[model samples]
Target: MARPDIVELPLAGAFHYRPHPHHDHRGSFSRLTCDETLRDAGMNTTWVQTNLSRTKARGTVRGMHYQKPPFDEIKLLTCLSGCVYDVLVDLRPDSPTFGQWTGIELDGAAADTLYIPSGLAHGFQTLSDDVTLHYSHSAAFSPDHQAGLSYRDPQVAIRWPLPITALSDRDAELPNLKILEEAL
Candidate 1:
């Protein structure tokens, strides 16, 4: 087994887990997550669900999404195949970096994961075809709690690497940062 080198991101509670793969005659292996490791790093450890996401085309954008109130969750997100430019915004009202955003390029070959704390909006732009992602969440999905800001929200102003090729109607209709704050 391998332990990931947990590097905290710019945002409070965000982290980048850089795993070192151990090589052998067969292949290489690494550990993605561990309770002891997470606990040592002061991260939430009670993951209740795991999910797999597959994106078939490059230049597709998904989210700027988060849950609200009692349903807010901590997420462990990893790129498993292909590449993506992952982005997130600090939506926590009292945080010093409130409304600020940050991004990182995640490569499947690196076998790394990003830690997203509660109250941050998370999204990604596929940088290669056939991208696969793994997600571990601390809470169950709740339609009523689901909310998002527009990917094109000028306030956040995310600089996606490629020209976007696809966006779902739901995402296209998400509200702006101002609306999110007012509604809260």
Candidate 2:
């Protein structure tokens, strides 16, 4: 597989990577990330941590979460199995698009990844059962720096594709944009 072709996403600092996967009788292989590719995009090439999550049920939503300054991080997100309706909300106070959001469908079979910049709260709804996601983070996690936004926030008004079947108690009670803006 060759280097992924990066496309600028609607949100400034966000990017979508379309990589060429090699397919043959033996199966397929794809390059999830490349240092030069990331460097060209002015993104952090050093990943401090890699996390894997597997959601068991469809229609379950996980996030609208971000980190505060000193721990805010860039992330490389990819769907490893099943599919998802991924979403991101701009939380950068100085950003022109602050309070705005964008959603994209990510298919597991597709060798694609999203370059998530700091100051963006991200979350996704599982489109199929047993969905797995991979995240490569530029900074280590800090409990004190963890933060989130409510999916029910009318201000952001995210139109999730499915009726949310499940959510963590914490995510359900997350504060809205107005409340988090000052801290973010």
TM-score of each: 0.97, 0.97
Each model's Cα RMSD: 1.0, 1.0
lDDT of 2: 0.91
Clashes of 1: 0
Give the per-residue lDDT of model 2 (tens digit) for 3-79. 77788888899988777889999988998888887898798799999999999999999999998889999999988
TM value for model 2: 0.97
Badly placed stretches (over 4 Å) of model 1 are none
Off by over 4 Å in 2: none
lDDT of 2 at 144: 95
Cα-based lDDT at residue 48, candidate 2: 94
Expressed as tens digits, the lDDT of each residue in 1-184 for candidate 1 is 6578888889999999888888999988878888899999999889998999999999999998999979999999989999999999999989999889999999999887999999999999999999999999999989999999899999888899999999889999999999998876
